[model samples]
Target: MKSSIKDVVGEMVTPFLEENHMELVDVEYVKEGSNWFLRVYVDKEGGIDIEDCGRVSEFLSAQLDERDPIPSAYFLEVSSPGAERPLKKPRDYERAVGKHVLVTVYEPVDGLKEFEGTLTSYDETGLAVAIGQKTYRIPADKVASARLAIVF
Candidate 1:
């Protein structure tokens, strides 16, 4: 059910993102408390501003109205993914190389499930994270999720 919604939303919103020379970071449909939220994350080379979010929200709203794809009432939101933006696809990971990142593994690596450090390298096989003095090579499949972490 959730996958279907994501696919539908991705399909509906992708053209808009591309037309605007923006990238679709992610789309999520989830229930929190008594309400459901359909959150859209978009970005570009220089990063996105509030105005970009507003435009995407307006355009997506119109598309949703015309398609009427979702039967349930869900609040629509469009925004930047923020400091800890998730790496949803291969390109995202590639772009995130040389940046600080936080990654959680599907299983423990070196007795640790979480890793936070600079992303030194990434390829089809795995990612190399420089944690402190040591570098750890984590298989791409072992990662549960990864995101660019804001360094203070």
Candidate 2:
């Protein structure tokens, strides 16, 4: 149910975001306590501001109203992904090169399931992450999750 909602919202928002030169980071539909919430995370070349969020919220709200895709009541939220942004797309991985990142894999690469280091390179083959003096080659398909990490 939640997954379908997320998918519907993603389809509705993609064109709007692309038209505005913004990137859709993620869409989440979840229940916290008694209330359901729909969250949309967006970003740009630099960063997203409150105004951008408001605009997205407004646009998405209108679209949702017109489509009525959701079945129940839910609060809609739109915002930036923040510092530790998830690396979900290929462009995200490309932008993450040379940045500090935390990555998790479905299986161990070099006997490790988790990796934290400077993402040196991202290619069709895989990723090259340098942790101290050693570099680990992680298959792209093996990545379960990835996010930008703060050094401090």
Count clashes in each candidate, considering only residues at least 3 apart in sequence or on different chains.
0, 0
TM-score of every model? Answer: 0.96, 0.94
Tens-digit lDDT track for model 1 on 1-152? 88888889999889989999998999899999999999999999899999999999999999999998889999999999997899989899999999999999999988889999999999989899999999999998899999999988
Which runs of model 2 end up more than 4 angstroms from their true locations? none
Model 2 weakest lDDT span, ten residues long: 121-130
User: Relative to the true structure, how large is the alpha-carbon lDDT of every model?
Assistant: 0.93, 0.94
Candidate 1 ranges with C-alpha deviation above 4 Å:
none
The TM-score between candidate 1 and the true structure equals 0.96
